[model samples]
Target: MTVTGEDSVIDVDPLEPPLCAPLRRDLGWAQVQRMSQSAGHRDDPVLRQIRATAAVRRGTRMTKVLSAAQVSGHLGGWLPYGFCYRACDIAHLHDPQELALLGTDGAVSAEVAYALRWRAVDPLDYEVPGGPAQPGLATLQAHNRVGAMILGTGFTPSTDDLVPEFVTAGFADLPMPANAQLIAYVPGGEEVILYTYQPEQHGWLRLAGPRWRGLLDTLPGVTPDREYVPCTTPGSAKLVGQIRDREYEAVADPPEEFRVRALTRAARYPVSTLSRRAEQALWRGVPCWVLQRDDAWARLRLVRPDNDALAATGARCYERGVYESWAPVGELADHHIADIPYVL
Candidate 1:
């Protein structure tokens, strides 16, 4: 096959190749040196000479290049391509069973986002948005019939904006039960937004920095060794994982020099606290960090760690699960550091 260049067609042999694989083989030495010269340099003696001879190529800009499948290939296995259902699919999210899928661990989390239908509301009663002609309940039900989708609240249109009056009522009765107090007294008369509201328990919920440690103070219910450990510290270190020698050789290549340093800082007093601390630390990055135990084996699973938090803080801690009992062995020396956990 002939690969077309600016002013030449270089025959590219598919089956055979050369050792010093030419990155710019199609271009002549003058062209290569000219094009590769300091892009905007006018003062350089060599660059000025090269630029004078070379024809400046104006390449066409690409518009629609990579398709969805091609883009997904580049993203690898992190996010499933087809799983991105749009805002209109919000109805499908209504199924109470679907809520279970939002969690990092097998645990379920209670979160909701209502799709907006309209904006006008009755002035007499703040709880009622739109008149009796356009019932709020019917609009919500109509959306519900379309099949639930994960509602994106971050979108421009929100349920509150659609029914400003109703939202005002919602805010007024913040502490009150929606069904009884807020939903009962709409001008047109209606039940409040009837969502299967579950108390947010299980999964990796964002806990306040110091407030999360308060759980440790209340762990008298559990056995002495099973107390909660608060893991909150910051620093960073080059993470080393298991790799075959050949793979390492390939990445390091031609007498590779390793210069990354591991960071150590105070988490809490006892070292066991480092496990949970690392898990919490990783909350800003990766998946959930949960310590799971099965029979004689135990592992820290990288399920749901806050990738955002990790990036925000320089603290070198695992946002996911860290195996407290795991140890370094063979050629993995001087990499691991012990962080003392904070004591109450």
Candidate 2:
């Protein structure tokens, strides 16, 4: 399906009130630090405010800036499933170059940066940190940041100036939402949209024009000529369009940020091959990407081979530079994709 210039734009009025007021009013870095040190109960006013401010309605656009490595992983068919913030919260950051630095910790990179965007499906999945429910977790994160600084790693400590961040509850991963976009921020402040997910076709539709097509070379397993690369991975969230009082899934006209002129010239080419990458899963409380699996056993590779992961799963390197072990299907926790959390 071809979408032209004005035809594809979804008009979102800037004045429209968001589902919930911005949390900045109720929570700040100061409040975060205070709550992190307090032994207050869950019903504390500050805690309640944090929870209320974090509430999101379905269809709200969420974004997560992607590192260069993450961009390659997505091109290799890794589903997005980690920390993301509501797009409306960061709307004030108009400069594409400045916005690109959100995920990179202000480190200017030689390579291009990217972002993953998807609409919200369920509010329960997102959680505001430093809330009463997870005070200890927040404290630990603060301590870790300080430790990093002491170790001369140049980690920025949380302060009153930073914005509040959220995480997927229990760090669980969600299925990619339909219409999720992979956008690239080039060096010269140009926001080049590379691909948009097509739910019905179950693949990413390459929308980068000739000028931007060169960026595809940086992504593994992706090329400019392959207009559609089939991905049958399941998605739980969807972009909803409303006409009058009726609602429909995967029918929403994309926002102006998502509609590029290249979309008009794009064609839905046939996909002759399918990706055979194994889905991500959790085993013995450790995250892993499946290498091979069957009804009873799964040959899994650890997502993070840190000491904690090794101790939790007893995973060992059977071959040089490869850490993996066989885990029974019954022992696996959740058969879901995992993304690296962007913690504050």
Candidate 3:
């Protein structure tokens, strides 16, 4: 088969290759660019341009497209071809067992997006337009069903998952105590602490003692690292420093080059929503700053330390931030800077 732009097709290429590779090759460029312009991906540039072009070719207004897997990480029965599930898969999410399949680390993260259907189970679990139904949501606090979930008889991790050992290590000894439904709650400002000395790294970073709670209302301006004043400094300062430290070896304020890339990309989107996302992405690496080069709409940067991250995020900054485009990253990186005074 031939893509619209490329005339040649490789022969004997199909010995039933991996699911994503074939689908990726066959997809129209528009979808690929949609992926780049999508969440903070930094995917292949060829893919980004093709997707971007395809998006425009369809119409002046472009809708982003992503592979099923790109939409989320691997799930029990999902593929680029079909049987897809979003990161949210609430049925899996509600149960700690199912939540274990989330990311490569299988650690608890806010990343998962429960399927819209799962909202029926607990409308309060997710944020809904006009602010999720807050009425009956209070009921989730005490009922035994609060954390209830359904799983396969012996749902063990498979090769399809990133964290095969997660289930065995995490809830294996979480004090079932007759398989209690709720894990008990700790009040706000309670200085809650949880720990383990397991010889595995599940999170992107590790900390020794109690870390600052990023949530303001819960701790009321308490910083994670008490080495520095908490409420006095903006959390954005710490976050920007953290991302830079991770993406790059050093931890300093973002440079002008970073901010310029952010501003240029944010220009591609509507400021009402994505500006904040653009600010946050500044440190990730440069974004797909679309500029007219020889009359062709192309990404300003060829490759970046992190690629395709900002565009899709930038796009999602619109109204609800569900479906993506490289918009949100651009928005956060570009907009949030104003709020972060120390970085200035």
- Candidate 3 worst ten-residue window by lDDT: 170-179
> What does candidate 2's lDDT look like per residue over 124-179, in tens digits?
55655444322333332222221111111111123321233454543334545557
TM-score, prediction 3: 0.18
| lDDT comparing candidate 2 with the true structure | 0.52
Q: For every model in order, what is the number of clashing pairs? A: 40, 0, 57
TM-score order, best first, reads: 2, 3, 1
C-alpha lDDT of candidate 3 relative to the true structure: 0.21
Ten contiguous residues with the weakest lDDT in model 2: 146-155
Among these predictions, the greatest lDDT belongs to 2
For candidate 3, the per-residue lDDT at 167 reads 16
lDDT of 1 at 101: 35
Model 2 residue runs over 4 Å out of place are 1-51, 94-101, 104-111, 130-161, 232-292, 295-311, 314-344
Q: Write the per-residue lDDT of candidate 3 for residues 150-170, one digit (tens) a residue.
A: 111111123232110001110
- Writing each residue's lDDT as its tens digit, candidate 1 over 147-166 gives 22212111111222110011
Error of 1 at 243 (Å): 33
